[model samples]
Target chain A: MIGYLRDIEKSFPIKDIGKRRQRVLKGISFEIKKGEVLGLVGLNGQGKSTTIKIMLGLLRPDRGDVKIQGHKPGEIDTLRHIAYLPENPWFFDNLNAKEFLYFIANLRQIDKERLKQEVEEMIKRVGLSGNEKKVIRKYSKGMVQRLGLAQAFLGDADFIILDEPLSGLDPEGRKMAKDLIKGHKKKQKTVFFTSHILEDIEQMADRVLIMNRGRIIKEVHRADLYNKTLEQVFIETIEHDRNN
Target chain B: MIEIIKLTLKEAKREKGFYAGLILLFLSLICYFIVESFAMFEPEKVMAVYALSSVEGLSIILLFFLIFSFLSQDLNKKGIEYMLTLPIKRRDYILGRFFGINISVFILAIISTFIYMLLHLLMFGVCPFAFLIQLILLMALVLMLSSLPFLLITASKRPTLIAFLVFFIYVIGINLDDAVRFLSTRHGREIPVVSRALLKISYYIFPNFSFFDVKIPIAYKLSFSTMHIVFALLYGILYTFFILLFSIMLFQNKEIK
Candidate 1:
């Protein structure tokens, strides 16, 4: 955080949040290190998704910039290191899981032989083994989430951005995702993740960046000092801001 | 680039309804000839026109289905967001889709061309080489026009209305231009050559489906001036490239938030 202050500073935009015309993401920004995971926590309209979009270069901030690996986010070369899971990830439904992965693996321009191996490993890791041959549309929501998680693991990009990766997952699926995220940490990958589930953020994120009304309001990092659940911190932070 | 194309092709194959439309188009070609058998105009002449026009007309109709099928498949199946997240640029994405559809449409054109020729040979006993050439040229023109609406609709946030407006304006432009020309002819003090040339040029530039109408002796067995096919094909391709460049420009600045 000490060396990377400039990263967040550069990423922060200056526009106001709620004016009708100019409001995709107003003045929201932050930075996390290569080995650090930053969990974005906020309510529905606070613009958590929009912030992620900016970081992924999916959306351009009207008044500021977001840099990934010292280059502007969304540039195709820089995006090679970034993996994203949307709020609702979409896949070719008729394609079986394996077929879908094979197709994406090519688009990512991963080597064909190596992609074959990686898809197998990722599916197994995500606990979607033999069902890999089944069409995606028939899968349960939790299974779909698992599929999305496995895809994020593909290409082996350095930075993985996931939005609500655990939202539709059942308890077991969520637990599996937590372990998978920790595994990403062990590999020294920088993870930018978002979720409304505070406890998941607490359990997974090394630090938390809280967004409010399209701006980043606070950063929570004290050695996971309290180790309080993300729910506890989110509530305390939002309520604290209200009272203040 | 190969990845995007491969994905698009796989998607098209997987959608049965797309192939179903292709089948229906084939049937329509045969039915067009059958109806042409009974036209009040010379059977040979009328059928020649319908044969060329029918292929182009079905193409125009089927093209809308292709756009709807592909676009809705992505949006409904959630596959589009996945493509967006990939390392491919949006320009490549758009190009890949257009090329994919182009290949599909070209395949159908080949089949329909074959059917029209076989019938022409059986009935008239001589090939409609000119009709075939004109059909090929017009196929390129109609296809570019078909692609423009989808591009605009997809590029804009409001796809449906924009697509409808795009098709309507083009349709009305062709119809109204000829209607005005007819009115000028009836009044006797006809529109001036300069004005007529201007209108024709606009029609030429504005996706003129009339160029596709091969309704005369030139269309049956004789060949056209080489200039016509070359110029028209060039015009259509250049326009398609322009529309694509425009779409890419719009997409590049769009905030995906």
Candidate 2:
């Protein structure tokens, strides 16, 4: 690992007697330095969302620290440069796609002319051919994913976090998402995305983070993205966990 | 801050149905006042009572839609996800919502009360300037009261449950005379600290919709002291301010999970 790694500790307390926290993550430790498209891979309940939430400052870690650009996630001023998208997000209904983009752009205080051009380009890039007059409810899962992706790319923030972005997209939509990730990577924007679509990760991730039982099991490299599929590595990793 | 305010206004305005409903209620209030003006037996009393209660009632009804539009609209439409992704503070968003709803309520009331000015012209041929001022003041006072409890509901896990609890408590408080007599053994003598404090706060803080019930007496040329009106308005404002301050504090710690 070229980047620094901190000691992380995660455990479930005796809270919630019957339905305790799904302790899918355990002492996961890794470093994502600048300019990395870290793909997070895990089966269901693998602490993917929780880890992402901790990084986004949504959930505080029980015993660990994530230094993003040398600042903790909860640091509001530091977090201003980060963009996050949950697995399946909900958005305002009345806002047409363009209006919603404009709303976020205004919140981020991006330049008016630049925001106009960028949103238009994003709409076009996602193959969401429109003037943004269409309400978001009209969008399919693929379209909503694209719309959320457009939002993530807004403000041109330094770090972008997307969870399971390609979960419900068609082949074409997946291609678009892949292209979007590639663009973010090209701009040196550090991206941490999680997904069940192993093939998409094989295509775009510069490095992969595989987890099991609330722990960082392995870090796969993109240079080896073609050497063996993510599925192969995942099966091997899960088998290793089972044996040990 | 102004930008946030502007954004809040725009967000609330997008709910076309909500503003439409409030506008309709305001229009109805104006029409009712106009019709009541022609009914002349104890005309002053009728006008004053209608003026106070109808305005208060209509304001609440008009505001209900606005509040629902702000509170339920996001959950209904799932629109807040996009909002939360932004770097904006959550309290800023909540306060923006508060501002947007109150602003709409204020505007609607102003329009409705303005129409009442025409009744004075058609009936007595006077400007009704003084009545208009009182309506404006009443609108401000009620706006403050109506939104005061919003902090409680917003901070709670179940807004509907909290609303029911609030209603139940209010009902009990309004009927406290009977409630305490039945609940206690001897003359309902020594109240608990919590109950006493609650009673004191409710009597002083809540809008005291009954105070304005006296409007009919005042409007009918019955004698009343200016000090009472002054005290009532002050209590309403102070109550609203304290509650809003509490909301801000709670919101500061709120994590919208």
Candidate 3:
């Protein structure tokens, strides 16, 4: 497995208020195989993002173990092989898109010779070619998302995790994002992505996991997706879990 | 680590506040020259005291604002997630930020010193070597002071709270000696023993910023020893290291939600 979460649990402390703690994830367990596109689907406030964070080491699990490539999450060596795009991607406002890409490239330790070429190629690949010089603060929401995609896909990361990668995209942009994930699939890269749009998951994910109220209530395979509409399955699963 | 440091410096350079602070420092220098040009007694001494103190004070304020704003932007805007997602360690992130701010502040100090030297030469026809040395020492002190805000930022997520905590610490740190002496003296005898003990303990708990203040000596052009400077330099290094270590510890466990 490229990624694994075993009985992961997380809770956030609420300060200066009556509420003491809010539990966000409850003993979630999952695994990601190499070269597989795994889709995590859920409504707002389910543990989808929390699980992604644990895998990316952004938020530590309050209980249980998380590992990437057999190393603990947040280990430098493990992160070297992974790339992440947050739900609401925010870049440094002061940096232009190219500069931001260069920054990420540098962090990825891309060689000086290939850095410029790779950044430019990624910019073009994300449909951000001409606007690379503009500061990120001036970019539109869709443009920022494009830049986020560009950064996440840059370099030779073996694993990619995207949180709501299609949130702010126009129809064309969304198609491009889907195509980009398809390209990653062709490259045999392990990808874990979360999205509200079931169609996106249907088109890209080899397997989908349905999360509701901090638990992975069901897992559906690509073969099953062919038998039933993902929207129906998602609605029924969430409704069934809520009813129980 | 180098990449993070470089990125931080680039960000700092692009920030309007960074340039604004430098401009204000220059304006203060110009104002000092204008004001001291009219002083009746010991104008050079007055200029040295005014210029060095102004530089030190402004540098601290600028650095405080810079650190607070940077951390605030990272937290509120989720820029830190970008860094944390990379192959960088949490300790490297803290150290990179600390060193980046330190370099920027050092550059500002150097610029201020250059202008001060030029102003002094124009007025007194001599570059005050002792004052230059004093400013260098102050730069070391400023570097040490920069770590405190990073430590506080790592400990707390709220920028306003961090600002207030840092300001509170600054005030207490600078007056720590006086506070400690008062608590140990007859004036503090009226207070309860527990309260007095707590006050004394607080003194040791907080950093002694007064050690960095060399204004009086620099103003008088006193023959302060090299040994003291060396000791202060060493102290500053060790103190900054410990503070940064604590910050890394806190940041390593910080959740980016």
- DockQ winner: 3
Report lDDT (CA) for all predictions.
Answer: 0.71, 0.67, 0.84
Clashing pairs in 3: none
Q: Candidate 3: RMSD over Cα atoms?
A: 2.2
Candidate 1 vs candidate 2: which has greater DockQ? 1
Instruction: Give me candidate 2's TM-score against the actual structure.
Output: 0.83
lDDT of 3 by residue, B1-257 (tens): 78878878988888887888888897897798688868889888888888788778778877887777787888778778778888999888888888888888878877887888788888889787666776777777776777887787666678778878877887888898787777667877888889888887887788777777777787787777778788878887888889888878887888777
Chain B TM-score for each model?
A: 0.79, 0.71, 0.91
- Of candidate 3 chain A, the 10-residue stretch with the lowest lDDT total is A13-22
DockQ of each: 0.58, 0.43, 0.78
Docking class of 1: medium
Structure candidate 2, residue pairs in collision: A24-A213, A24-A214, A25-A214, A26-A214, A26-A215, A91-B78, A91-B79, A92-B79
Residue lDDT tens for model 3, A1-244: 6878888888887764576888888888889998999999999888787787788888888899888988988889999999999888888888899988988898888999999899988898889988999988899999999988988899968999999999899988898888888888789888899988898898889999999888889999989866789999999999999999
- The digit string of per-residue lDDT tens for model 2 on B1-257 reads 44556665666666675567566666766666676758768664566556555555666665655555555645444344345446766667566666766786666666656665565456556555555545655665555645554676545545455445544544543355545444355544466768766665665444454443345544565666778677757765676677777787776554444
- DockQ score for candidate 3: 0.78
Using TM-score, rank the candidates from best to worst. 3, 1, 2
Question: Which segments of candidate 1 are over 4 A away from where they belong?
Answer: A1-26, A225-227, B29-42, B73-81, B122-125, B150-155, B187-205, B215-223
